[model samples]
Target: MTGPVSTDRASDEALAELLMRWVPQQRWFAHKSSSAHLQRLERTPLDEGGVAQLVALTVRTGLGDEATSTVYAVPLTVRHAPDEALAGALVGHLPDVDGAEAWVYDGPHDPTFTRALLSLVAAEEGAGSPAFGVHGTSADGGLPVPAGASTKVLGGEQSNTSIVVSAPQGSAEAPLIAKVFRVLSAGDNPDVVVQTALAAAGCERVPRPAGWVDGTWTDPSGATAHGHVAHLTEFLAGSQDAWRVATAAVAAGRPFSEEAGELGAATAEVHAVLARALPTEPATPERLAALADGLRARVAWACTAVPQLHEVAEAATARVDAVRHVTGAPDLQRVHGDYHLGQVLRSAERGWVLLDFEGEPLRPLAERSVPDLALRDVAGMLRSFDYAASSGAASSGAGGEGAGAWAAACCEAFLAAYAAGTGVDPREPGSAAAALLAALELDKALYEVVYEVRNRPDWAHIPLGAVRRLTSPPG
Candidate 1:
């Protein structure tokens, strides 16, 4: 029941204070529980009747005497009723600031933010300049926002924010999903680059991109503009992310044997498509050595943090060394850098559609973009199944045979489908790949341990149990 606040009249200090309290409450806030100091970096007025304001924030965390900084660009929409459908999308309640309600996100609400957002989409579709301004840079220097056919904020992603944008309205039946990069970092975002290439290569497993937006932002010194990827395309709708579906199936106690088989087959088909799309490169001794070294470093870290991972880490490192020279078909392809159940969608008609070409968030952007083994993606998916099962067990407080049975069923179904579709025998050369995957899972678990311990201490037990399972001897 509050009226709209004019962007020009709003005080930056008041906005910063509101954001500081608001950020810690978001599910995606990495340091949600930690104390933070907010500094306003930039504020841009949305063209949509000037009712919406996009504010970029640089927050410094106070850890003891040291303070570390992180930046977030949040778009806040001020409306009286807004839309009821947007209620679930609210990040936090705005302070008792007179008579206004503020809903903030990477962009405005789903289905495009007002008519102005739609206008940006139209401009991009026509290959013209964007109508909106990019924060942190002079309005004249920033890259124009791409025109979208249709747009909606992807629901259910717990990590980074994703917005799907299509070309001009009704230009084509198919639209693009331009994901705006959040938690900004230097270098080209792999997801933007690789997926575009895959689409060009006629890889059907990934959505085809119509265009992308990348530009430089002036640094604090104003000496040079650091490169950043703002958003890019290829959009789909009404598709359910695979992980959500699988988790629901398990929780409902419904057998996923058929779906697993289909998933496996779909995964194999995707590999085949990717193999055709990406260039192949030999796995040199130097590369293998580097991989081994990285694994060793991860093992060491895991051992220090989670003692249960000691045995698994040692075994995995040894196995990787053993296969260092055992070459089969050359390891070739632009892989789905961070493949997992959560990164795929199951279209009722299209089967499996992959998403987020961005590799592991912790890895350097260059490494994520480089070509790698197809098995790496396969291994990532297999680990996802394990994670899904484990998460279900933890949620329900069910352990032992019941949990094991459920996990095993899902594994069998998925593997059966993958093997039949891809023609790669899981028990043959793929075993080495599987073992390597197990090692990576351990690495992922260790990473999770640190993340959970810092962010959600209450949920730290999830990764702790995974570490125990990975290192424990088979029964």
Candidate 2:
């Protein structure tokens, strides 16, 4: 006995109802609290002639307000029989689709989909329906990921799903890792674009990108918008993130100043290369004014979100003014927008390697394309050092007293090395560069305050402390 063929309209309506039930439970879903009324934007078939049909879909997760609505990229394989191998990746059951016994499985976990995903990318094919297109690009001489390769989905990812693909035919073959964007937006996805450029420029600090998928989708307003769908890169073997190494050093009371300095130098080199490789614009007076206002806005937001920030709000805004007064700031360049200990991986072969070129994940996609001061990355690292110290101290029971001094030492060492390479020092307490860095650091801390308040109230103390220390530094 087989179910009747589900008409295209009926299938979409059923799928929309299913998504309303399924998406909220997904880790990649953004709107956890708000009620979602999913509107299918577009659906493109990745592969249609197989036992399982793989389709890529873009859906709007909310209704009415354009600002409130979020777009999501959803890919799934519709098959006749339940794939016990992909049971864990199962999204739900679809009773009818092209007369097959539709059992829907998450795309990344579907072997048929993952295999074709890379092949499409390697072939650099642009395909889709009348309303939208999905394009793929593979680097010159890119190798193929064999069909039915063993793939595993990484756990604990919040915004996207990552799949680790291995060559099942041989153990010696290097593995591949692919990131599929869950939330979709038009324009540049720096994670794909920037890193791919850096890799093509022979930058060793970033993993070499093998291939990527970009897509164009019709919005509710019927405008075709483009953005990256996924990225595939080499999986670094025997690599550990710098956060773990940094924290271990602090926990054991071992000096991390040397490593910090090296990381800073590495960061500076990446910035230099990025500045050379990408577009840059002078920091015009108007841009500076807008920057100051943006900083002040963050401070205001933090003040409202975290009541403790209210007391120092005036002083925080004052730092923004100090930054505004500073003349001849560095030219805006394309650097790692979100640079921190966690975003770096330490490898015995490669040393300090930077990955994830996507700026701040929470920031709007359009804003990320505009180049900005590289000092923002500097401030982000400075904040990361503080978190590392705080965690190490808490774990060791050595208290924030020692942690503060250690963090200060590391910060100073980092700045000193970075300044040596960049020819612009941000270390001196009263210097112009220092003023700008302070303002930027405070803004980042305010961001952390909001994040910690919403996610980890206990950890809010770390950022709150930075906010206070920045506003009123101890003599």
- Steric overlap count per candidate: 15, 0
Cα RMSD (angstroms) for every candidate in the order listed: 6.7, 3.3
**Per-residue lDDT for 427-459 in model 2, tens only?**
766776888898999999999999999999989
Q: Please write out the lDDT profile of model 1 over residues 208-252, one tens digit for every residue.
A: 554444433333333333334344444556888888887776676
Question: TM-scores, in order shown?
Answer: 0.72, 0.93
**Model 1, poorest ten-residue lDDT window?**
135-144
Alpha-carbon lDDT of model 1: 0.59
- Please report the candidate that would top lDDT against the real structure: 2
